[model samples]
Target: MNKETVEVIDRELLTDRDYVSPGLEIIKPDKCFPNMIVEDTSASDWPYLRREIPHNWYVDQRNNYVGFLSRDEANIVYNTALKFRGKRALEIGCWYGWSACHIALAGVELDVIDPLLAKEDIYESVTNSLQCAGVMDLVNLVIGYSPQKVEELAQQLQRKWSFFFIDGSHDAPSPLNDAIICEQLAQTDALILFHDLNSPDVAQGLDYLKQKGWNTMIYQTMQIMGVAWRGNIEPVQHQPDPKVNWNLPEHLPNYSVSNLSADLVKEFLEIVTAIRPYTLLGEARLFSLYSLAKKVCIEDIPGNFVECGSYKGGAAALLAFVIKRYSLRPRLLYACDTFAGMPDPSEVDIYNGIPANLTGFGVGALKAPIAENIKSICKLLNVEDIVVPVKGLFAETLPQYKSEIGNIALLHADGDWYESTMDIFNTLYDSVVPNGLIQVDDYGYWDGCKKALHDFERLRGEQFNLHRIDYTAVWFKKGNFLPN
Candidate 1:
């Protein structure tokens, strides 16, 4: 027990007052800065966490409740829970119940604590919000402060949290108390999420936790939200092992007439023949390939999911849908892209002709709002917990992430340009486990993307082989690529 805990046990009321401040006067808001309420727009543009805040919603010094949780934040919570389905969870300071709702929707049982909700009116609103989102039944709400109420509930329920979120009070002692109690209740593989870690009060709490051996990963920007996972700290040794349906040929489309539903076959042929304005594969092929890749991987490999070059997140969106439909285990999916647009062509050694897609950056050919639309679909489908969006180019960002694909069964490379394609292939290829499959989007379509693939093969001599598909090519690595 620490000083505060000791003080509490010694019959003295430990002051939550220390968590509050008054003497220092800061500039008061003339008009509400509603932006503060939603997931701070300035928050790192990691696609999974990037969410839009309403203009009217602002953070009030006293009782701030304007901007609702951004769609992205809500989606993050949803997907995390989905990935940890059947795992126990605790969420401290669940305001408005958006994160809690996402957790429940992801099929995880939850115990949510919010002392502020002891007020009946707030309780009613919380219930209303959860009900509105159709997740009221998933939560076991504990209405009181931590240690006291949380401890009592833990004693009664005898539940241990595998995942915890500290989003309640962004103050010192309050969050510190939340962290202390959470530490006592977390399981070995537990993950703790802290909101507003950049704030002075919360930073103190985060600092204290870090001192106690918690590994913190900071997602900093407007308002820092730090995630600390409590577990055996070991260097991750990921080996990607993407697989194919040994029976499924690489070059052949999965859209064979025999396997398709009558309706689907008709729609596909119509689209392929250009009888319809859209090609199902042209319009939805990217995502469908993503879906197909994830399905093939999950069915064969034993690891999490990831996709590079996620324009409109179509591929990732398909991955989430498949994970949900199959009741797959370990439901997390990561999607990486330059949400603003593609990287500068000049910077890319290959793919010079690739037009800019949306952001006036890359080869401007792909649509801009597709990724946003994928997010919207994620919310609607209630699979937010299964998908995580990393916003940025593959070269600038993905190389840093510690992947869990020690058994990567499938990899989808859709950069469609040589530089981007080769970058991802070079960076992530070795991570693929044995017998893994790497699917390239523009293997046959783009000159640069194709050239990069061939060059990589020629330079390496025996890294992978081309499985010529009808419209695209699938490369299966017999062995891993040594990093340059």
Candidate 2:
């Protein structure tokens, strides 16, 4: 993964609801768990080894240190791959050496494979980590990609990897190809593991393996990560060993961070600001919106992100940002809007109910972006690749996509009128995945928006886990309790 993709994944993991770490450490050797080496790389010691790496080794930018592997998952990687130490081991990706250091320290004789291995000080930093762990002499840093580099390993190193760690390119064809290449080079009993099993592209790759009759078992999934054993090999899940150390510092539980950093908060706020009235929603609301998107994603909830009234694309941009931040590849943001301004309000949404000063809203008040305008904003934000602009009235456009629609992760209805809001609710509500989210911008402030919400709840005959962010905004999460 490149720096952007890795950072996105890192930030998303930090804000996870289950996360509880000592706030970002001011970088120091003692803070990085200095000399806290793994005593044994045995499968039996996995519970012990996992508690060794710190929550973060957050060094400053001058050294270009970036940590992407989460503490719990890092333990998974170390214990799973390092058990085959002394036999040749292959790692498809090792960005900045967070996980690499631990694996090398376990004496895996690791061969680090990545195209970016020689770029900047990445090579030096990974080596520096190995040197710190005193395993530099046992490892070889390979520079090309796995599929392309697979051919040269036998000629140069003349050793088949008994352990394969596939954390390389997270996209589809690459992961599928990487698995095939590794399978060719591995001994029949090689222990191969893949990271980011929650990712759609990676899942597709896993599906490819199953198609080939490979006996791949998803050994671990607590952190939405998995290990796959190839060539009829069964996956061994680590059962907790009572004799081992299983403590996380009171300040850090499972290596979690309570929240994002100040710099990141400022950046997310600024992005929402740039497209302001396009979104009448404020930072707190937008953050809530973002949190919902991230939560659904982290839970491995199935769906694409959607917005019923995108305006000039502010909220859409926010969703796009979340998807990119988490490296949630292949997630498309459907920014649906009329662009021609709001249609007339229904009798239930008469102008008299809104505030006296804003009664004209029923006459098409918030005229936002045309199709071209939304495109420009998405382009300016560098999210044009995934945030698509859909034009025309919701009643007309939403139905066309219904046949092609998959489940939805988020649905923000800001149509302002009962006819508009309820139209969208009835049409797309069932398309939402279980545990997905829905945000209503005018919930309490506007009677029509409130009316639409109540009607949906009444029809469903169940209440939602609604959270009110402010007087004007409230949101609810769809439960996973599908009735029998």
Candidate 3:
């Protein structure tokens, strides 16, 4: 770990003690500014921060400016600037200069561009905040919109920027455009940070950088923040607050199994609970697989149930159980996998164009035990006779058993990579009976899985009317649903 000392100004000197805003308090700085030591740790590991905002700078602004930056976010901006002190920096949007104040205070030569800064009130407020912070000389306030104004500044200054803070429009194409334009004016080892990554639009901008080979990490701030940079320098990591609800809600309003009997729901819960040790699927996803499998069996859909990527056969056990409990006709559940581990991911298997291996989807990942373990799971579920463990890669086993696997009722696709997912669809899609169900487990989580589904749809010249099973899963009925 490397340590650097940063000089901090007493916050009491920066804010007017008499200034007050409605529904807000103007509190004095708790302590005097001291030279603080910040640890510069290895980029690969999460950085340990003794204090988030060592300076504890606070500004009392009007209600409109209050929500722009939380205390923690303000500290992040200040510390980031401190790390890159003496380097040129650009900020795309500065509502009332809250963040700009922090950046300038860290000794960075800052340029702030925003159309709102053209308005008299906003411009005055920004300048006032900067002047009060004692860093007015560090900032060059530009009154114009980005991309256009950013391009003009790039040409005029003819200087490569080392740090960027993009908090522009949260709309699609706008964020993406800002990133592309700023990238051109950035140094080879520049660090570009973006705010509002919770918005899918803002995330697209970061995705563009990741595709361009920049190292990236997302900070779980209130609105979420993302950082992208080239070369060896790693940005300091922010630990997420435990009090915040970080994970997406599993039970969405759209998820409904009202049609299912209370008894059936109870039975599913029992079965899934029993097999929970063998699967990585959450409760929502497990129920989705169970309900869909039960649907095909109850409706007497012609064909057997097929599961690709049956990791540990937990889900396959559920499929066989549904056939045993619901299907009036005899149907087999074909559980397929290598019984070894995942094959090597192709180039197309990536997360927003970042290589799969870098994101934890590498060769031999998500490996299941040998085929005997799957058989043991089936025997424990009392579906041993109905569940058949087919041990091999999908590319080989799928075609080899295509004859015996004639006419599928439901195809549960859990293969996470591009090639694995595509191989299952290519070989088994034709065997599915009309209106049969195809459930995809990683549609939202893996770019490669989504691409395979899309490419297959285009090849068949038919767009599927996909139904959301959860945040990461979706299913569509074959030959019955189409895009509007």
- Write one digit per residue (lDDT tens) for candidate 1, span 1-484: 0111110111011132111011011111112222234224443433322233122222322345333333223333443444354567888887656567656655467888887677876577667755654556667888877767778888998867887778876655887888888888888777777666545566556666677887755542223355666653111111111121112212222211112233433333332232111111232233245335545645655555667777665456555655666634665667777766555554233322444343233454454454445576566556677777776678767677635433445577777667888887788767766666677766654566777887877776764544332234344544644333
- Alpha-carbon lDDT, every model: 0.53, 0.61, 0.71
In the range 9-63, model 3's lDDT, one tens digit per residue, is 3223343312111111112221211111122222112121112322232323342
Q: What is the TM-score of each candidate against the true structure?
A: 0.41, 0.45, 0.49
Q: What would the per-residue lDDT of candidate 2 be over residues 106-202, giving only the tens digit for each residue?
A: 4557888888887967787777766655567877888887687876876676768777777788777888888787777878666677766555565
Going through the candidates in the order shown, the clash numbers are 38, 2, 0
TM-score ranking of the models: 3, 2, 1
User: Candidate order by lDDT, highest to lowest?
Assistant: 3, 2, 1
- Winner on TM-score between 1 and 2 is 2
Q: State the lDDT at 232 in candidate 3.
A: 31
Q: 462 in model 1: Cα distance from truth in Å? A: 29
Instruction: Score candidate 3 by TM-score against the native.
Output: 0.49
Error of 1 at 7 (Å): 47
User: Which structure among the candidates has the greatest lDDT?
Assistant: 3
Better lDDT candidate (2, 3): 3
**Worst lDDT window (10 residues) for model 2?**
1-10
